[model samples]
Target: MGFISNVTGTLSDSISSELKDQHLETFRTDSLGQDILVKRAVRQNSFGRNQGSSEIISAGSKVIIPAGTYALMIDNGKIVDSVTEPGIYTWENSSSGSILSGGVKSVMGDVFDRFRFAGEVTKSQRIYFVNGLEIMNQTSNESLHLPYPDPVYGTLYFKFKIMFSFRIVDPVRFFKKTGKATTVYDYMGSPALPKQPFTEVQDHMEEALNLCGSRDKVPFPQLLSNKSKLKDAVNETISEVWYEQRGMVVESIAMTGLTLDEASRKRVEQFDSAKIFADDPAALQALVALGLTKAMNSAASNPAGAMTGFAGLGMAGTVAGNIQNGVSAFGGQSVTGPETCPFCGTPLPLQKPLEYCPACNADIRSYFQGMS
Candidate 1:
């Protein structure tokens, strides 16, 4: 048979064959002129042959030329391979040409190029503000009113210097969920100025500390005695606030230092003084003793002095004696002793127990007996 007639006969036979029974095969030539077979289903325009050095025309088979390659001719459902370089080739669908081109390339070669979709990345970290830590972020004028003004507030400016660290956990989720690393910054950073102003996180921290202080009604001196506990309470409250509100976990919070403003410091010092005097049983007892002595001396000097001054002494002595007896009953020491005549060291009698010294006959007791 002649070359043209033979090719036509083959084409007719292939075209007439049932597609369900016969499968079509595709081939393309490399730069080395090696024929490589690519298997695909037979379809319209599935055949082609090299019509020229740079082109192949297919009449029934679809073909994939590499990104920078060309096609020449087509015939039947088989590809007549003829080419001049190493590149990707696939059987293209006439209806969905090159739809699976990448798939074919991946099958034939290593598909190492990867595409990833990322949204946002977020990181969480912990900060520590040690006890007595002075925070620099707070403005000098800003102040918090703690419930126990004596222990925590009163013209006191608190400042703390804190250490903070952060790390990324769910990078993709952080990016997608939060949108930026700064989301955490915004969550933790100081709020705006003027209305909220710049208060150290430690200020809030201290406030939380003072909230726990409310559990005790004792004075500041008593609270300060357990300063370690105060610090722990502060750390706990601040950490909880951060975790619950911002969805960030706290690793550690410490207070590096604690300070009191000048005015508050002075007030605290004064309070300390008052506390010392108020708490001293000995001093209180001495005051009571002196007053009783004075009344006894007076009664002794004025024989008929109506004894009113001695009456006050008698009442005070009774109350003091009862207090002493109660203390002794409780295994505690007595602060005051018996009321006596200042002139002779003799025990006095009340008018109700005659408020006068019988031996020295003195009048000496006029004084305030309750807390001043």
Candidate 2:
């Protein structure tokens, strides 16, 4: 029912010398790649012919488990034993009284009970190897829309392209969920494999992105640099579907691209332009000067008359010139002094002391008075 570690000179007691010579052969698998998740083991007959599908594994068959792979001994469509360690294993029939008398029960008692099978009577058995390496390059063409809240720019929405990888941490659970295939289970390439994990991750991506951005207070431009937090948030979001049920966990994620839609881009540009002028008074004064130049050019070509246009231009120039003095002359509108609100920087709305800022609702009375 289970495999015992192979020891020299011990097969003669359980198997006849002639039978051992015919049946005892090593069963080992080669290194598996990221795409291949599982592979069924095969054997050859005494005539060196391939035993395909209907071969019965005789007692005393040696199975070698290499590093980064797990082997399972299945009998009659049920998992009888499994080997996670890398070494040589010899199959010992539990029904054989001679082998069980030598304290083989202590070796396989817990494993046999785990699957609720006392022993396997028939020789309908097979060996399978599971790849334990990290499967990489799992990509999704679907774009995830992340709504990121920026303290300075309000909420900005963006689309992101993410690439992620996963590894099988619990082979037993994974094998149970995805049973034995004909020969190989191609996790990445096979169309027969279910696309639950990929689809589920994408389905939950938006929520995870929101949680990551909001919880960590990451700005919209910094989401790409915060890939680690995003990855953790995504894994935590889909833990029930991907990790708990499928025995697979996301190993790493790389954010390939982040882009804003046209509308969002225009909004950001407008805000960015405003911030540049607000942060630097010299920049604002330069913009006002440009406006004055355009007005004078339009006045010279005015159809009313050169003198009449010049009169209008003089009034516009006065208002433009006052921009440098932190106040506008037209309608006596005050251009906020250099001191703006510390929180939102919204010019403090005429610099009058107020209890709260109307833009961001921050208590600005103390801050406004201190600046005044």
lDDT per residue as tens, model 1, 296-342 = 78766766564776776677677665444433343334333444444
Candidate 2 residue-wise lDDT, 83-175, digit = tens:
888988887652221222353443243223322332222235678898878777777666677676665567877787668888878777888
- The worst-scoring run of ten residues by lDDT in candidate 1 lies at 121-130
- Per-candidate TM-scores read 0.30, 0.63
Off by over 4 Å in 2: 1-22, 43-63, 75-121, 140-152, 159-162, 182-194, 254-258, 300-311, 327-372
Give lDDT per model, in order: 0.37, 0.65
The number of the candidate with the highest TM-score is 2
Candidate 1 off by > 4 Å = 1-141, 149-177, 183-207, 216-241, 245-271, 274-372
Clashing pairs in 2: none
